[model samples]
Target: MLDNYEDILTVNDLADMLKIGKNTAYQLINTGQIKSVKLGRIHRIPRQNVIDYIIEKSR
Candidate 1:
């Protein structure tokens, strides 16, 4: 479903991709499990961070 692995992802995007709830995705970001950058009120999650998180969890 991922068209571009290099593109940055929003919280909603991450949630949809992982098939998780929005709150859970936010929790992961808040807990620092998924790295993110804050832009004012918006959080931008790097594509690589999501990939890394998946890899870490798989191991």
Candidate 2:
């Protein structure tokens, strides 16, 4: 779906897609296991960064 190809994803969406908890997702972001961009007061995770992280960690 086109919607699934978004440039950025919310924390909730990340958890749903990765089958993880919000806390775990936050941990990943905070620990730099995943990349994120903070805009205003919101944190947005870029899709490409998540993909890259997955690939890097899978090795």
Candidate 3:
């Protein structure tokens, strides 16, 4: 469903998804463990990219 798709997820969204803290989410973003894109002054994590990164790392 289109509603099930989220192109960009915020830090809170990522934290909730990963069941971690906001600080941890920010740490992942900062440490490059999680992939993200910056729009203007905002940082957004692409859901697909995060999934892909996890999958790649798992392998």
Candidate 2, which ten residues in sequence have the lowest lDDT sum?
1-10
Candidate achieving the largest TM-score: 1
lDDT by residue (1-59, candidate 1, tens digit) is 56654489999999988999999999999999999999999999998899889999999
Which is better, 2 or 3, measured by TM-score? 2
Candidate 1 regions with alpha-carbon error over 4 angstroms:
4-6
User: Which ranges in model 3 have alpha carbons more than 4 Å from their true place?
Assistant: 1-5
Using TM-score as the yardstick, the better of models 1 and 2 is 1
Per-model TM-score on C-alpha atoms: 0.90, 0.85, 0.75
Ranking by lDDT: 1, 2, 3
lDDT of 2 by residue, 1-59 (tens): 32575788988878877889999998998899898997887779988888888789899
Q: Please, what are the lDDT tens digits per residue for candidate 3 over residues 1-59?
A: 22354888888888877779999999999899898987887789988877876688889
* Candidate that beats the other on lDDT, 1 or 3, i.e. the better one: 1
Rate residue 34 of model 1 by lDDT. 97
Candidate 2, 23: how far from true, in Å? 0.4
Clash count, one per candidate: 0, 0, 0
Query: Which regions in candidate 2 have their CA more than 4 angstroms from the true location?
Result: 1-5
Model 3: worst 10 consecutive residues (lDDT sum): 1-10
In candidate 2 the C-alpha lDDT for residue 22 amounts to 97
Candidate 2, residue 5: lDDT: 57
